[model samples]
Target: MKKRFVVLVIAAFMLFVFGSMAEATVANKQIQVNYNNVKIVTNGKAVTLTADQEPFLLNGVTFVPLRAAGQALNSTVNWEASTKTVVITGNSNNNASNTDLLVQIAQKNQEIVALKAQVAALQAKLDDEDTDEDYDLDKIEDKLLDQYGELEDVKIDEIALKGDDDFVKVDVEVDLDDYKKEWKDLTEREIKNWVEDLVEEIQAKLNSNTVVDGMIYSTDDEDLVEFYKRGKNRLDVYIINNYKGVNASKVIDSLEGDRYSVEGIRFSIGELDYEEDKELVNVNFEAEAADVAERWDELNRIEISDAVDKIGKAIAGEFENEDVPVEAVRLYFYDEDNERLGSYRYNNN
Candidate 1:
């Protein structure tokens, strides 16, 4: 009983001394003096605190580095040297392990920057490829000149390429005077065959040209081919074999015009007569003008003439004359009654 009472008195005396020391430190300079009995533990494991950050006891008061203490307690630690302050934070409860996590974050940012640079470089390469694919007449013209440089019978005056990713249109002008000298009396059919052969050669060379992505251009693509004379020269170097991809059936489908009679007369084109020998296309159609049969001559001369001209222009895009002049658009007109009216011809001669 005496021993227990003595032990309680020693414990009360120690508590009172420690409390007074804490109050003094808070009120005074808060400086700590060295005491060799400090220890640190983290997550149930003993941690060896750094020498500079070792805890100490000053006049019976304990002191520790804010960083070391925060880490030991699993709390984030930040020191403000300017204000001489320490801040600690955590998710669920303030926590921290070591400086390794900060290093990881920095490395991740660098990787992201590198990836962005790689993507930008790939995009630049693709843009360059597209530019090469776009048509450039200078390159094509150079190729043509190189191929025909030694030929005395051919002179390429101009070359042009146009169109988009869907297709490419090429136009080449050649001086055929030398060609004519060789075949002065050649039939039109023979001349047309010769021109086609020339086109094939040019098309093949263009497909294999090195200026762009080779093998991307083709002449077999429908509606992607055309031939035209050079500007202002008008000496008909080449011809569009299938202009606008229009034909006799397409022209017949495109005819539409009113005769302006009492019954609102309309014109309808029928069978197309191709006079290859004379270079003419005879358009035969019946005009529904039953209300004004007596005025057939006047109507045939004026109304029919104007109608034929308009119709010819509309269907002219379908012709494949290949530099051969179309002498005229011969209109063989008949009334709804099947009576043959006088024919009227139209031409841009």
Candidate 2:
């Protein structure tokens, strides 16, 4: 009878120990959950839960606990429960923080909204201008052919005309051979100008009765040339078309100044008069070496000129092929005092 009691006591003790071990294992195990396409894992493994997955709304801000999500992504996390936000800082260099991610998402949304607004505004403006009645299709075609010689052989594939509307959509199909034959002689700049002029003329003809507010978008090669021709006394004036409310005189005045070259300062003038009763107007000018060095010291901060010279030397050394000649180097200095420090160019030849 005593032996039977001992066996019963031992069995009871064994069961109790096993039960405690099972409970400890359950407590130590990790839980996993998924929310808003982001995987959240607790500890090393995924947590399985049947809770309705919704964005955690706390204090008017949406947040997810970083500790729950970071382990799955192999990242570090810190939770500020007081602020109801979890900051999941990634261990990897490419990993972005939750705050940065949110900001980026917000910026993308703003850009989309802005683009939609712009499109709506443009559509409304087009609709208002469409009230004009008179539009001569043949005249438009003739003008296009005259301006763009390549378009002369182009066949009008489709023409969609709306009744009493100023604007008509015309799609043209051109023969590649004819286009190449005619347009090959024209420079890229000339081609761009031709297109812009044609568009402006067509718009004007279409909206004869309505006041149309539109701008021509084209590449200005002349502006690029002006930008490159530093330290010249004369500027080659090329105005494609006169734009209303734009101050052309002010722009011309701004360009008239002393330009810098690597060797010296070059003076530029809007207009010049020489001997034999000949007047040179809008000329780009170049200065002597002595003048440039003197101006560099006076006008520019010492470090800027040195930095520019170093860069120029590096460039010259890199492309030291016999066919390529390093002609000149120029630097434009715009410091706190002088905002319009003219561009300087260096010429070896």
Candidate 3:
């Protein structure tokens, strides 16, 4: 039979064998019982029974020992005289003594509950991301063409809008045909004014239906200039926009006398190394370490990555104000032992 061994734990039983074992034997006559060549087979396995406990027939009625049968089925047999009952039970241990399987079942149930909770959480996140907001790219691009098609030297090449909610992706490609100065000859003021105007027009004409985070003014797909919504005035600069390199020494002189501190790390600028070809600069600090830092002891025990980040902000900030030709700057830091702690590069600064 298909079965799971379940134990009721408490038990009672009555058997024919117990009657013959009474202390005060009764005066009685017994007839011979038949063996009948009986065999005990349980779930395809043979069970050996003692001769005295074997199957027998009394007055043509068949009987078997309860204890032997229960043992063959991996169970417990109990006899209760007061209740005149026989109880059979099966569980983790043969006699229902071990509860290890019950404990394991409870643990597995808890894990299943935890796993189901995780799945529910992930599903909630997906539903939140599946927003209904939509922007028609074709309609927006066509409207832009209608607004800027009349400028002889200006060409509107491509425009695309994507994503949902307040944050969205908007990229524009514009090409200048001819009758224009090289991009480098155009000053930062000139470049910033042109792009900002276009951005304002796009926002007004579309009734602010789209948000532009960046725009590229190119020639035959060659990126001549790109405007990003970051920097000193937030949207006031471009990458490699102004070509003439600034005097590196002058930029350093402006920041050398200044001292800045963040998270107990006092920092000062020493020298500025400018690479004209790469349009990059390495702004170095004066000393290997700083003094008069009250919390330096606390900072020395931890990582110095974010602790010393703002040290070079004054230098990069000054370079941006002067419309410096450099595209990026690298900042180097040292620990108390003169060992390099970390190096960081600020792009489009």
Clashes of each: 7, 29, 7
Q: How do the residues 1-349 of candidate 1 rate in per-residue lDDT, one tens digit apiece? A: 1111101112234345444644653343545476574666555566566768666656654455556655655566776778545556654532243466777889999999999999999999997875674345567557655664322333445445564333345554444444434322333333334444444444454442321211111133222123332222221222223222222322322332323221245556654544445667677667654744565644535555676677665454446433434567776666777776656576746
User: On a 0 to 100 scale, what is the lDDT of residue 247 in model 2?
Assistant: 18
lDDT of 2 by residue, 281-334 (tens): 122343433334446566554555554565445433332332223444343444
Q: Identify the leading candidate in terms of lDDT.
A: 3
Q: Listing every candidate in turn, what is its Cα RMSD in Å to the true structure after a full C-alpha superposition?
A: 19.0, 24.6, 18.3
- Candidate 2 local lDDT, residue 214: 22
> What range of 10 consecutive residues in model 1 has the weakest lDDT sum?
1-10
Candidates 1 and 2, the one with greater TM-score: 1
lDDT of 1 at 131: 63
Residue pairs with backbone overlap in model 3: 12-87, 13-79, 13-80, 13-85, 13-86, 14-85, 14-86
Model 2 worst lDDT run, 10 consecutive residues: 221-230
TM-score of each: 0.24, 0.24, 0.29
RMSD of 2: 24.6
For residue 205, model 1's alpha carbon misses the true position, in angstroms, by 52
Q: What's the true lDDT of residue 100 in model 1?
A: 62
The full ranking of all candidates by lDDT, starting with the best, is 3, 1, 2
Model 2 bad stretches (over 4 Å): 1-133, 147-167, 172-174, 178-186, 208-298, 301-349
